[model samples]
Target: MRKMPLRELAERAGASPSFVSQLERGRTSASIGMLRRIAGALGLTVADLFTEENEVGHRVLPRAHRPELPTGPGARKYLVSQRPLRNVEVYVGEFDPGASTGDEPYAHGDSQEIFVVLGGRVTLWLGDQDEARSYELAAGDSIEYRTSVPHRVANAAEEPAEVMWIIAPPTPD
Candidate 1:
C-alpha cells in the first residue's frame, strides 16, 4: 500500500495534522463534507480513496477475500473495492445488538451516504443537532442522507443488523 505521512497529507489537504492522524489511525470518524475537502486536497475523487490500484485488469473481491475491518467489539465491515481510492466506497456492515461503530459523533466533508437495510433495526444518530432516528429494516428498507454532519449507527434490534453503505469519497478515520 502507498501511504503518506499524516502531517504532510493534512497540510496538503488543509486539515489539522491531528485530524489527519486520527483519520489515518481510524481513531476519529469524519463526515461527508470533511471527506470531500480531504479528497479534493489530495487530488482524488471520493471513490478513488476506497478502490485498490490495478495495473492491468479489474479485480473481483470474493467474500472470503474481502477486508473485514473491525469497527467495534460486535461490529464488522467488509470493504467492497480496492481501486479509484477517492470518489466512492461500498461496504457491508454488521452490528450485533447494542454494538456501536463509535461513541463519538462522526463528521466529514461534502458527500452523501446510502444505507440499505439487509436485516434487523438500527438507530441512526445525526449529530448533536437532531434527535435519533430509528428504523426497522427488513430486506428492502433503505435511507440516503448527507454526511456533512456528525452521525452514527447502532443496532437496536435484539438480533444483529446488517447494512450496505455506500459513501462518496469514503468515510474519514
Candidate 2:
C-alpha cells in the first residue's frame, strides 16, 4: 500500500484536498464522477470502496445486515446495500395494502429509475400532475421510467406489495 497524503491524493484525483478529506471522514458526499476519479487515482475501482472483504472482497449483502430506510406508515423499506455508493441505490419496499408512496407524483433530478414487483401487485403512475398514466404491475413484472418526469407507486391489492427499486445517481430528486 502507498502512504500518499490527502493533498497528494486529491491532486491526483483532480479534486480539492479539503473535499477529499471531508469525504474520507464521512462529513460530506461526493458525486459518482468525483468518486470514480479518486478511485482511478488510487488505482482502484469505485466498487472497491464498498467491497466487504470477508472472503477476498465480496459485495454480498445479507438480509439481516441491510439497513432500514425510514418511511411513512404507507411503506417499509430497507436499503439493500452498504453506505457510500456514489452512483446507484437499491431499496426493497414492502407496501401495505391500500398504501402508497404519496397521492401526488414527484420528480427527482434527472436519473433513471427501475421498479420490479417482487410480490403482490402495485399501480405505477408515471408523469406529472398535468399529464400522467398508470400501469398495473403483478408479481415478476418490472418497469422503468424517467424520474425526471415524476412518478408514484401504490399498493392497491388486498395483500402487501413488495418491490425493488433501483435508481441511478442515487438521488431521489
Q: After superposition, how far is residue 131 of candidate 1 from its true place, in Å?
A: 4.4
Reference-based TM-score of each model: 0.62, 0.64
lDDT of each: 0.73, 0.80
Candidate 1 lDDT over 74-145, as tens digits, reads 999998865454467788988998997787666665568888878888777765635555445565788777
Q: Where is model 2 poorest over a 10-residue stretch in terms of lDDT?
A: 49-58
- Per-residue lDDT tens digits for candidate 2, residues 1-173, read 33567897898789999999899999999999998888776545688766766344447888888888667677988988455544577889999999888888878755678999999999999988678899999999999976687888899899999999888755522
Highest lDDT, which number?
Answer: 2
Stretches of candidate 2 above 4 Å error? 1-56
| Backbone clash count, each prediction separately | 32, 2
For model 2, the local distance difference test gives 0.80
Maximum-TM-score candidate: 2
RMSD of each: 9.8, 8.5
